[model samples]
Target: MTAQHAAAGQLQLNYWAEARLQRWGHIAVPLSSTRVAIHGGYGRDGKKLRRLDDVVIVSSDGTVAPTVSSTPRPKARERHGAAAVEGGFVIHGGRAGGAFGDAWRWHDDVWRELRCEGSPPAPRWSHAFVALPGDACLVCGGRGDAGDLDDDAYVLDPATQTWSRVAAPAFPVAFACSTSDGQTIAFGGGRAARFADAAWSELALDDATAAASRRLAACVCATARPGELVVAGGVPADEGEVGGVAVLRIGEDVKCVAEAPLDVMRAYPVHAAAAFSGDGVVVFGGGVPCLSFAPVFGDSVRVVMT
Candidate 1:
């Protein structure tokens, strides 16, 4: 694996060898400055299919260890959205036996269900979520029960333990990637087997992109620099299940500053995860490319330097 500096302040990714065992559909949330917490996903334990419930902590130096939580654990589910909040990490809406509207918070080695006032978004999975300013989060678009896809949006204030619906998007999307750079939240990608709308909406800017567009089912993270978003590991509409990555500068003009191919091909509806490190981003497990029944999971981690 090698890293090369790129033009436009974009970081070239160095693909490392597979460092962890194969797993996908897991959620990775930053637990502290140097640790990331990985939650449930499906993988193989021996010859049988396994739905995992263990909490694994990944250290800054690339160490993966299990954490024993003193409190109750959330249900084992995949395609969940997780983000670090004020007091802890909040995970919301994933598919277990079916879509879920329940939310849980993990803090101080404990897991607690978050019962919010008013209504929350409908039961869904594969939604896009980003940490908003002031200890809040915005969740938008996901596949609902019975194959229903939604365009709705909602905001959660962990401080108040409340949820409020925001204006829905102009077009429905799911399994899309999203990231926030303090001031703006940008989303891309859409459902599998379809091209995402060419335009993406920026919540804070109250604007959408006009010329730049690509269908992606990737994981995304913000760089240390403002107004920069990095998207990694997803299939493009034209590329089928091939893995692709890109960096977007969301400013006066929203455009892709850099683009490249992932070390391997991946598919959509795969629950991949990303977290920003000191000066780069780390992407975790995603579903391997498939053309038939059942998906082969990926066990590697890729780092993109910014």
Candidate 2:
């Protein structure tokens, strides 16, 4: 594990590690204090892309294990979104041959397809799905069927299995990452998402450094401290699409953490999965070698406070 000095907010990058046979565009969410569950991704090891037919659980000790679901789960998918909720993780909208509009939940050792009463969000991939307070969920912006980015948002009430349009402006991005503290949510990719109001009300900018970042693509992020997030690994707009490990702050100003970026011991880590565990943020699984279509294996990188 390579170590770096702490600078920005006094939080140091603990070390870099390898990732597990996950492929590109999979969904990942925290399962426990030291482990995260990764599901559904595709690979093009040769030429044609296909779904990876399995679920993987990654532990902080750098161990990767196959998850044996006692109940049947959804078919292999890619570029979908998953959020940790009260009982289990809720997954929604992604693609294999084409984009999907279905939603499912993993609970009680079972997988159940969620049938929305009315028209749910249109078929999409890489949208942001997050758990909200009261166990509700918010769905927003993603690449839609017509190959256009969506500009709408909706909230799902788990109790009623109903969808309500959020009375606020939607996130202007797709393929971004989002996390919530049951009160505030932080999201973004090419741009930063708001995280302050418990209602996810329109956010007020910190006027700090959220304005300093260039639009990034395929970036992953996790909420760290309250009102703070740790963002890493994205392709900058003008950088010829090469992935890098630059650390970015989304909510408040760029404060703690080292000034240097964190990188993987293996893959280039674009389109990776991220979740906060203990004092550190764990980044794992993605298109290895960056733009190249390769699978991730072994240990995953962890960025922790010193």
Best by lDDT: 1
The local lDDT score (0 to 100) that residue 24 gets in candidate 2 is: 66
**Model 1 alpha-carbon drift over 4 Å, by segment:** 1-10, 17-21, 174-181, 189-213, 265-270, 289-294
RMSD of 2: 4.2
Tell me the number of clashing residue pairs for each predicted model.
0, 6
Q: Alpha carbon lDDT of residue 221, candidate 1?
A: 66
**Over the stretch 149-243, how does candidate 1's per-residue lDDT look in tens digits?**
56667888877889987765565553333345454444444211111232234432222221113344567766556776666665555566644
TM-scores for all predictions: 0.81, 0.78
Q: Candidate 2, clashing residue pairs? A: 9-256, 18-299, 18-300, 19-297, 20-296, 190-216
Superposed by TM-score, candidate 2 places the C-alpha of residue 62 at a distance from the truth, in angstroms, of 2.3
lDDT of each: 0.63, 0.59
Which one is best on TM-score? Answer: 1
lDDT of 2: 0.59
How far residue 31's Cα lies from its native spot in candidate 2, in Å, is 1.9
Q: Cα lDDT for residue 17, model 2?
A: 45
